[model samples]
Target: MSLLQVSGLTRRFGGLVAVDGVEFNVAEGEIVGLLGPNGSGKTTVLNLLSGALAPDGGSIRFGEHAIHGLAAHRIARLGLARTFQLVRPLGSMDCRDNVIAGLAFGAERRWGSAAQREADDLLARVGLEGRGHAMPGELTYIDQKRLELARALALRPRLLLLDEWLAGLNPTELLEGIKLVQSLRQQGMAILLVEHVMDAIRSLCDRCLVMSAGKRIAIGLPGDVLSDPDVVRAYLGDDHA
Candidate 1:
């Protein structure tokens, strides 16, 4: 059975339909890629699923619970966590404290020394070991992304939504990110990843869903979806395809 189920999901801003009748699912221990060119509504889908935006129609089920219009905090408490395309860390706080806050307020609500220890462990897991004392501004761009991942993990979510988390990484950092994602899957966390990095998609996703103009255009294995003529035309110009 699917860990998450989304059907007929739709959203709009004024007259623009950002996400239109989209559908997909994620199974436990699976990583599903949501791929599309810019303005294809990938991030908007994430926003709707994470409760940052309420859908105008359709349904989203996490396990047996209906999560369509719930507030973001409530959705988060239900073991759904996400990282933004633009990383947002508590700038004034040190890396460790930022993670600690997630532990203290997240799904489990762990607190005190226990939360601190778990935060440290998460930092190490994300390759931010021994950098816990540094402020967010003091970290490199990739390290900040790591910190954001650490914070999301502190929520102990069953399903994670990642939006463009691999966008600006160098080759080495990208490889590390791919390994980290694989490790999460091994640990039984399901993921819905929105990424422009084709290599990352090929390396990490178990299956992929392709979107164009707010609609789902294809769903299949990564290699097959990327090879689809429709996908090529949507990404590259028609002439190039």
Candidate 2:
């Protein structure tokens, strides 16, 4: 069965339809990509899945339960977690403390000392091993991204919704980011990554869903979807795709 399922998801703000009749599924242990142009509604879809926004019409199923209208923290308790496009680590808190914050405020929202052990492990998993006491402001841009991943990992989610995790990193950071996500897949967690970086999508995601104008345009393997002229045009321009 699919680990996460979204069907007929629609959201509207006045006359603007941010997401319209979109349907997709993420299987267990797979890394799936949601790709689209700017203002194409990718982030909005993630927001709905993360329960940050309610859908105008649709159903979201994690495992076998319906979670469309659950509170954001409720959704997290069900093993659904996400990271934002912006890395907002606490400047005063050290790396390990920042990760522990996820347990305090993330899905379950009732974590105690036991979650602290998990927090330490998450730091190592995201390549911040032994850097637990370092302040967020003291870290490099790449380390901040790693810290973000660690924070999300601290939630112990079965399915992760990553919103543009690779947006501002350098080439080296991007490569390392691929390794980070790939390791998640190896550990049997399913990820639905909504990203604009086609290079990362091609390398990391097993399948791709291309969206444009708030609708799904294509769904298939990375190479196949990336080669589609419509997807090309969506990324580059009418003349380029």
Highest lDDT scorer: 1
lDDT of 1: 0.94
Candidate 1: segments with Cα more than 4 A from true spot: none
Judge candidate 2 against the unseen true structure and give its global Cα lDDT, from 0 to 1.
Answer: 0.88
lDDT of each: 0.94, 0.88
TM-score of 2: 0.93
lDDT (tens digit, per residue) of candidate 2 on 13-48: 999998999999999998999989889999999889
TM-score of each: 0.98, 0.93
In candidate 2, which residue pairs clash? 76-107, 232-241, 233-241
Model 1, 101-172: lDDT tens per residue?
A: 889878679888888889999999999999889999999999999999999999999999999999999999
Candidate 2: stretches off by over 4 Å: 105-113
> How many steric overlaps does candidate 1 have?
0
